[model samples]
Target: MTTVAYQGEPASNSSTVARTLYPAGSELPFTSFEQALDAVTLGAADVAVIPVDNSAAGRVADVHHLLPESGLFIVAEYFLPIRFDLMAVSGASLDRLECVRSHVHALGQCRKVLREGGWRTLVSDDTAGAAREVAELGDPRHAALAPPAAAELFGLRVLRSAVEDDPDNTTRFVVLSRAAVPAPHTGEPTMTSLFFCVRNIPSALYKALGGFASSAVNLTKIESYQVGAGLNASRFYAEIEGHPEEPRVELALQELRFFSTEVRVLGVYPAHGHRRTERSG
Candidate 1:
């Protein structure tokens, strides 16, 4: 059976994704993203399911910084609709709650409910961890904001269900493996993720990205960050909506490489179904 690793307790959002993708697989949880990725690298787990970004909270894990350094490749992507539940000990009353606890992202996502309750906020490493703490504390006055499944996992009662501020909040997760498994170029919708560092010259970035526009290749996302302890050295992480093997995409990448000091193709995976749904909607 596949051993899936993720950075959260059972029933946390990451666990939910793991179960959805590999129902028969055993799950291994770690305290941090790095630890989970390390498990996959060291052959302790087949792959790691990690959250990259959320609609409501923006970036969850800095995958741009972590992926290249970890030497892992993205094998697949999943979109999880986020829902937070306010939960506590069995006898907890919503009106009598004095404090709320959750991961910082959960707290930020459920601001509407937190604002109405006027409760003190405490941050935990994971939303499920917060619920576990509430159950262990046996304190009716302290409630946790966590995934709906977390209440059942930790034997806590749900004070409120679906408390997220945005009804359509969703998180994007990536499956990482130690080896590259580039999807076959079969004309299906695909996403190519890569990292590149442009040569430090005038208009280097602008010139580097011009290839995509000229080739009519659609770039879905791109972001730059400083590298090598120098303000002048900038590296970029980008996602484009085509397989690298395609003629236009290949041409664009060639042009990109011509102007870049370094270029690495991180992954080329089939695009998640949610991307199509989102674009059509």
Candidate 2:
């Protein structure tokens, strides 16, 4: 069976997504995303389920940084809706808060409520971990911003419910495997991740993207970062729909092959947004 590695403790959203993404696989938990990638590299896990981005939280640059060099392929994508809850001890009230703790994104999601009382702010590695920490700390003054499911798991009280800025907040995660698979559906249409460095100059980016536009390949996302390749060198990453060789997609890739200094397609996989309720793993 495939063993899926995810960062954070059991019951973390990442783990939840892992089980959803690879139901028949075993689930492995890691303390960090780096460690999860390491587990897959070391063959401790057959794959990794990692959070790449959130609609409200925006880009997760670290995931992008790690992806290109990980030597693993994103075999599938899963979009999980995020619901942040304010958790405190059984008898704690909003008026009793001395501080609030959570990952930066979670804290930011509830910034208004957290800032209202001038409570001290704290950061943790993950939202569930913070909720668990608050439970272990036992201070009524300390609360955690996490999911209500996590609060229940940790025996904490849901002091407030669904406080995220966006009701439609969604997190997109990738299922990493040793080898690429025929776009996930396990069986439909999905996105493929690609990483490349464009030759630096005017229209370099425009020209690189021209293929997608010309072929009607449905380019989904594009991001750029400095590769630190000396004076003013930068690279870009892109995600596109369908495989690189499907008629129009093939033609587009051929066009980009010459213009890009370095080009690599990360993987072809099923859309994560389509698997919101998966529970196989």
Candidate 3:
């Protein structure tokens, strides 16, 4: 059975998505995204499922900065609906709870419930990990904000369910493998992920991206961050809605390369059906 690596304790949203993608696979949880990616790179796991963005909380900070250097390929994508529950030990009461703990993102996303309760906020590594800690501590004064599944896994009682700020809260996860497995050059929908660094010339970015507009290639996502400590150089991570082998995409990439000092294709994989559903909705 394939061993899937995820950045959280069992029952975390990442783990939930991993199971969805690899139903019969064993799960290996890591404390952080880097460690999870390391597991796949080191051959300890078949793939690492990492969350890139959340609808309510925005981008997962760890993933955006780590992916370019991870030396892993985006093999697939999965969308998991995010839900947080207020949980505590079996007999713990909401009135008696003094402190609430969870991942920073969860705490931020569920600010409404936390603000209403007036509990001291504590940040933990991840949501499920916080729940496990609460269960192990067995303190009536302590509660956790995590997924409902986490309450069941950790033997905690749900004090409140669906406490996230938005009902449409969802997280986008990407499965990474050590080797490149580009999507077939066929008629099906696909996405291409790449990293590039443009030159320090004036209007370089505008020139580089002009081809996409000319070619009618849709650029779905683009993020730019400084490389190392260099203020003059910046690297970008982009995702476009076409396979790299396609004629239009190829021409666009050719134009992009003319203005870029470096360009690396990270992956070309099937776009998750969730994107289509989300767009239609």
Name the top lDDT candidate. 1
Tens-digit per-residue lDDT, 104-210, candidate 2: 88877777777676889899988889988999999999999887778879898888888887887888887787777756333356577888887767878778789
What are the RMSDs of all candidates, in order?
Answer: 1.0, 3.9, 1.3
Higher-ranked by lDDT: 2 or 3: 3
C-alpha lDDT of all candidate models, in order? 0.93, 0.80, 0.91
Model 2 TM-score (2 dp): 0.90
For residues 81-128, what per-residue lDDT tens digits would candidate 3 score against the true structure? 889999999889989999999999999999999989999999999999
Give me the overall lDDT of model 1: 0.93
TM-score of each: 0.98, 0.90, 0.96
Greater-lDDT candidate between 1 and 3: 1
Q: Each candidate: how many clashes?
A: 0, 6, 0
For model 1, where is the 10-residue window of minimal lDDT?
224-233
Clashing residue pairs in candidate 1 (N, C-alpha, C atoms within 3 angstroms): none
Instruction: Return the candidate ranking by TM-score, descending.
Output: 1, 3, 2
